[model samples]
Target: MTSNAENELLERYGWPIEEMDFGREDDPDVIGCAVLEEVEGGTSGIFVVRPGLDEENRTGFAEWAVQRVGRYFEHGPEPDGWQKRSDGGWQLWVRRVEMPPI
Candidate 1:
């Protein structure tokens, strides 16, 4: 609902639940990914938890869908390869890009 609430949820993971379809960037597919369609409210969304890097100040992607779902509360949804599934669900794939060898 509110950003504070969202932040509170993300505080533990460090993955910013970036709004889905908020913006588009030049990137490729990632290695790991996750898609979450709320089992209750029916609010569908997606996010990625990388192993080396996460949302803001962390490293790694969620190892499970159930865990990834808890990474909710984003201002909107995920970014990049996040897509809408046939079941009206959401899907997020890791972006495939080299971070300039950083």
Candidate 2:
């Protein structure tokens, strides 16, 4: 589920921001959410974009985004970084963030 505000924010982007339920309905604290590519039983309904960069420079935007987001999470394993594959692909190995005990 998603809140009205989240939907509104996502609506500004249009395509690729598919209807996803991140387990946050009316919770304001659920400010950060993403539709990642590596999840099991995934949906092709999701995607990514480097809106701040030009098409030519978006080569590693996904990796960059992962490292950037890792900086703010409450808890994550060490060595959070991005890697480039030999096949001209990029991957970001992120840690499972530890959420606060509610």
Please, what is the TM-score per model? Answer: 0.37, 0.23
lDDT of 1 by residue, 1-102 (tens): 324534543564444544333223444244455565555845544454434443432223333333445544443345333466788566766544547764
- The alpha-carbon lDDT assigned to residue 84 of candidate 1 equals 67
Q: Residue 5 deviation, candidate 2, in Å?
A: 11
Per-residue lDDT of 1-102 in model 2, one digit per residue for the tens? 433433433453332322233444455233222332222552112333322333322323333333443442434322444344464333343222448999
Best of the candidates, TM-score:
1
Alpha-carbon error at 41 in model 2, in Å? Answer: 29
Residue 75 displacement (Å), model 1: 1.7
* Clashing residue pair totals per candidate (backbone < 3 A): 15, 0
TM-score of 1: 0.37
RMSD of each: 10.6, 13.9
